[model samples]
Target: MRVSGEKLDDQQIIEKIMRSLSARFDYNVVAIEERNDIFTLTFEGLMSSLCSHEQQMNKRINSTKLEQALQSKASIGGHGG
Candidate 1:
């Protein structure tokens, strides 16, 4: 599903994206709140560990996307062409 430039619904999009990511990562991330179309995703655990894990995951995904984009491969949100 793609949401383009239009009058989109924030809460629904937030939930949809959250669910899509959670499934992709195989983790149950609870949406604490959806504020201004941003979902505060969280898990029941230590704050430090959670933050670190999130950062690591984000970093790895970014790196992989960058590499693929550099190699003229597919990516979700890495390029505008």
Candidate 2:
């Protein structure tokens, strides 16, 4: 994932990403790496088979929420600190 903002540094970007993921998923970060302002995060969590329609829909909704949260954060010009 890529995050960029005038007021955010590398650490803040990583923290925001981690917070967003943890807020929606019960997962643990297994590995993380950053280079050239891009972040690669590996996480482990329970495996679920989206065989039911509700399950699939929930997954899509959660993904959309995550994407929106990330985009909103990236667009913020400052932390107001």
Candidate 3:
């Protein structure tokens, strides 16, 4: 993930990014590099998991879409209605 801010300092930006990521995913900061005002953060999933960040993000998106679909169906007299 890349996080950059014009007003916030590097530490502040890192903290905010970490908080946002921790809220949704289980990960550890594997590496951090800064160049040209951009902060590049590399994360590794916990428990020696093999899933990449892109895969995890895709799963979260798909799960959210499924939940929304289920809710819409239920609201319209479908399953669980």
In candidate 3, which residue pairs clash?
none
Residue-level lDDT of model 2, residues 14-79, one tens digit each, is 556555654334223232332322243222211221124347668899999999999888778456
What local lDDT does model 2 show for residue 72? 87
Weakest 10 consecutive residues, lDDT, candidate 1?
34-43
TM-score of candidate 3 on Cα atoms, chains taken together: 0.37
lDDT of 3 by residue, 1-81 (tens): 245435765565555655556533533443322232224332232222324665878898999999999888788876444
Query: What tens-digit string does per-residue lDDT give for candidate 1 at 1-81?
Result: 345656645555545545665453334243333232233332322234346668988999999998987777545445866
- The local distance difference test score of model 3 is 0.52
Candidates in order: C-alpha RMSD to true structure? 14.4, 19.1, 10.2
Highest-TM-score candidate: 3
Regions of model 2 farther than 4 Å from truth = 1-51, 77-81
Ranking of models by TM-score: 3, 1, 2
* Residue pairs in collision within model 1: none
User: Would you give me the overall lDDT of model 2?
Assistant: 0.48
The C-alpha local distance difference test score for the whole of candidate 1 amounts to 0.52
